[model samples]
Target: MSAAHDLPTTARPLSPEQRAADLRAMTEGELDVLVIGGGVVGTGAALDAVTRGLRVGLLEARDWAAGTSSGSSKLVHGGLRYLEQLDFGLVREALRERSLILHHLCPHLARPVPFLYPLTHRVWERFYVGSGIALYDTLGGRKGVPGHRHLSRRQALREFPGLRADTLVGAIQYHDGQVDDARHTMFLARTAVHHGALAASSARVTGFLTEAGRVVGARVHDLETGEDLEVRARHVVNAAGVWTDEIQDMAGGRGSFGVRASKGVHVLVPRERIQSSTGLISKTATSVLFLIPWGRHWVIGTTDTDWSLDLAHPAASRADLDYLLEQANRLLAHPLTHDDVVGVYAGLRPLLAGESDATSKLSREHAVVSPVPGLTIVAGGKYTTYRVMARDAVDAAVAELPDAVPSSCTEKVRLVGADGYEADWNRRHRLAAEHGLHVARVEDLLHRHGSLVHEVLALLRADPDLARPLAHAPDHLRAEVVQAVRAEGALHLDDVLARRTRISITVPDRGVEAAEEVAELVAPVLGWDQVRAAREVRAYRERVAAERASQAEPDDSRADAARLVAADLRTGA
Candidate 1:
């Protein structure tokens, strides 16, 4: 994964001085766009605008994808549920983007998965469900991934024997893509950086640098270092999905559309506990629930409802959990329960425009506007169609720029890990033998890190101890933790656990017991002293404990308070 020296992969904290230097070089020597927020959409926008030959700088209030981006159902599907709502335009756009990621842009990161839609009613239900899935398949996205297949009861049972025999008469198994949402967002930011974009996490936009009623740039606080730095640009793009209005206000006023926060909660369980080869998608009375396959865990979620809780930490309430378990358990042969839950994660979706009465009916379509001079805000849109949103955001920003801007080149851009991934995968056995690890273990690392596995492998070569798996969570190698701290800009233990590796949610006890071990692993790379490391571990545990306690609460208000009580161990805190 070595590249030009401009994009260094070093074991050092990102500095405001370095960013300021880069910012100066960007604005004085070259300039086009400055994007705020580090979610998938913002990262995508940065990559898009920069590759279009614009000098770009992207800043995030927290880590990339720390907000809604990390808290997805982890599926890159075209929203099959949207089809029933007659949102053909939305579904088609997403399906097309899903194809681009699967077949081209990030083939390694986004891979197809099969999901069985079990039919409860006999003849009518089968036909109704079959037609919907048929359209889902034939809409013929930018196509390399497979199509949907109809299954008889016998065939469906063969595919997933865990379903209750009496519950479903037949099924339709359809294909969709999935990804590590947080990692993908991080990669997006990294790819943007690789292309000469100055991207920084934990850089919050406190106020707009305005003069004569126009946003010139932003006044940002480097949360980790405790310094305020001004980053100026000719045009500013606010791709802040959830906090679009907040940024708009900072830019001097609010926009025509308002972004409402909707909470989506997901629970994690051991993979084998599901007893299904294919994932499951079921209809709920109000919404839908998807059973997704994570690496070692099965992600069953997600409960969607409007949430006005603390934006940072959205806790899944007991009622929400009850609703999901009740819905999913309707057809399962073995019912899931509280004890089966290893982790609970809730993400807030920025349902923009606030135009719909029903949360499920709310649009995922994004809108871009220059609510004020020199500022562009792009909000809404599903995760699947982020590139489109990015492209749109850049187009609007281009209008504000006084000079000609190059056409976007990100459609052809591959993230660091995408290139040479299949070849490395084909040589998995050799990699395993060479590294003295099991072929399965090597394959896991290969898929997760792609060609960048060599980066961690290089670390292990430097220190053999890095090759040993973590004491608490044996699934992830200790080297990966160190690599995250060194190369991935993991500012804290919670960042490493919650988003970087997902060990916090995948493991039981929310990685409480693993916190100290992880703190020890990342300390040397991050230059953490005994006090810093211990404080990190303690903070992470307290956060997890607070989330756990919050889930036991009855409603969002109590849950929000409890989750906030943990005091956010993030770099911003």
Candidate 2:
């Protein structure tokens, strides 16, 4: 290997200064490709383009993965239920992607998680479900994760003691990949930057820049500074998730294809509530319900229903919460009530609109189209296959270019912190000793930052005060809050408490009690005054209150109304 090939793929830090530099670079010269949206696909598209040696610029209306990307079920499965629908191709494609992520692309952030499917019927259910799981394992090639294994009722109960005895006669255990979706997406954006892509969050595309009849680039408004500029590009790709239709309209009018929004909600409970060694996946009347294990909590979710309400903040209704709780409680020995929920969240999936009346029946398959001469729109896909979607989108976007554009090299590109991760993990105990912390803390940091945990430890070594855990949230060190701003592009307290860390949903207070401390910790890096810090805290508390109020409402209308009560700190609702 050459010296260049031997060099590590370093992750460039995303800071306030870097954001300003990226914004400046976006306006200085015309980019080869300009991508809209900061979700998984958008960031993935940027990574794909930049690695192909294209001059790329990515813009996001809000923080990275603040949308549906962050709010997913956090699974990178092959859509096990899709097998029942006979969508073998989609399942196969997703399974391949899952394998790639688990073993190659993002091993540190994504890992294999086991899911137990409880059989209600003895002979028929076991045969039927067993065949499907076998096909699922076969389709996936069973390279990175484990294959399906059949278990008797006694064995099933041993794996999950909290399950009701009457719920199942036997079970089948299978493996799927799990991730910290928010951090994964953020890392994607950062990796793109490391590979030479200019990206800015809270930068909204207000309008499209046009030539006589051909699309040119985009007119963006910086939400942070309230400055507007025209960013010219050779080709512009819109990867907005559920907001695809809105972007299409901004381009000119609705395109030939349409994207519909399907609402899915999830709730968090204490991990002790489910005494299971493995996760649970059960069939529901409308869709599938997952009781996946989070760090210290269990994430029980989701109801799939057509939604036509606020796109930015989709509210979780009382019915949605009740439906999930009811469905999950059916199989649990001890039923969980509203009081057991520590956090509540809702996200909208951008499904391709077509013949099926049911939103759940909508296609997860994606489409990439050049709506105009210099504009491309890509949407409609599951999070697991974002890389394929991005690769296809870029291929379409660069087809009309005058010069030859290289094919995507992202498949071979390991994400930042992924390189040398295994070796770093093996030395974690030594790292803990060197840093004067417990092995558990070192392991947690390693998982969160992979090889870059050294950078975070450096911060703690400089400021001993940062070594202590946050007052309200003890799981995270105060240095992580500073790291969120200094390295992860966290501009506001909510960014730190919510996306940058899992404090918001994982904590009982939804990070309300930690809001002030976090705000103060990030204030210096973000250049916030004491008054601004106080304001950020107040806004975060109000936002949490509004979310709680919305979760109490019976329907979408009341829920949306309650959620809107707390105006968006950046956009003011």
Candidate 3:
């Protein structure tokens, strides 16, 4: 076994042994900041704080990005619609972050993706929409991506062959960044660990540890081992996203601001279903619809409606699916039905509640407040500006410390696997030759693991069978599953299929056929026997079944009830 000191700081693996060590460290020392939640904002806050030379500990109730972070539309662009809402500052901030993500932060994980906005009305609409995109380009600095392009009806049809000729008089194409949200969040947590911060997933913060009405730390419950630990810190940051209110209540007060949950659902269809080279974006009655081009699939989505159901499992009802299909069909020459959808996912947005009853009108602006003397609550921001949210949250926490701390410098800190990504991509063919794998396969691994592809290559060197692709999920190698457990902090089969590899959403069976194979592959690394492995597979299948049943329901209440039938394995329901 390699010693902790022997590994490169950027390459430190979040293996099971590392998790145990982190948990022990959390209990042993009083950290400078203790972060609650492991979503993008929370993990980003942990990374920001640790890099500022402060001792930090991050805790997540479930798997990393298991909630809202994993369920995003997977775009990292300035909200073009928000510009219509007259939010210029937010748009400018997000566009700057988008540029940083594509160029500096996680170049391997995020890249520029083009989207075409179909204009139905002839001259007026074209000028209006085209002007907004031009302004968007100006604010974005036109740095890492191309500026907007105006296409006539003939040109638009040529670019997107699947579009209906009658629906679009013209189109405007703009560029935005896209990423694997789950893997990006996991990388944030691991990057914090690399900077000497302690982080443990499946560790729920049950209550706040208070000292004479000032928040000090938290009472954490480890779902994996069923152990309760008291982690002490000088200050605590509640970056819980939609769960912000719940954490604030534990801190013993209603926070200064309120967070309302808005349900957004996305559906995945085969790439061939829409013969578009670029993505599609259109205006909806409530919000907007996006048809994003994911690998081998087109991700169409998003219905913005208020949700008051189960916060953990936001269900996508039949109405939600129909609404999305109805919107997408308005533009597509070939209408898509329910049969065309291979996968569906739902996520909740933590919108800052305003006077408007419609969640769509709620503000995406974030607020950072110290509810108590030492507890800081950061909530209500979009995914594109997570780094700014993290920086502001850490700034608030650092204010309460006795000594003066440095300002946020995360803009300069590249995430683990970001360094040397370009050089690795240039030499991907050589790597494939060395590993006796296809160059295409090596390229895929480079995108997912960046310069860290060498670590996965070592696995193939030791056990060549691991290089074989999974029978059901041919896009992913068996070695990827092993790496998910041994390197990425994946404790459950769902973590590997659903988050680490995305086999759950890409495959037709939603990873049901791959569950047993993935379970057996990671069992030894996780110290699970045959019975435990079988139990994990059974739990994953039940979860998939419940999700399917929920999608068939008519409304949110019924869908929530259907989804509740599958108990969470970590919590045992």
TM-scores of all predicted structures: 0.95, 0.98, 0.98
The per-residue C-alpha lDDT of model 3 at residue 46 equals 98
How does candidate 3 score on lDDT?
Answer: 0.92
Scored by CA lDDT, what does every candidate get?
0.82, 0.90, 0.92
Off by over 4 Å in 1: 1-30, 570-573
Q: Which residue pairs overlap in candidate 3's backbone? A: none
lDDT by residue (345-423, candidate 3, tens digit) is: 9999999989999999999999999978989999999999999999999999999898999999999999999999999
Candidate 1, lDDT over the whole model: 0.82
- Model 1, position 460, has a per-residue lDDT of 70
lDDT per residue for candidate 2 within 482-542, as digits (tens), equals 8888778788788888899988888999999999888878777788899888889999999
Question: What is residue 259's positional error in candidate 3, in angstroms?
Answer: 0.9
**Positional deviation of residue 342's Cα in model 3 after best superposition, in angstroms:** 0.9
TM-score of 3: 0.98
**Candidate 2 residue pairs in clash (backbone atoms < 3 Å):** none
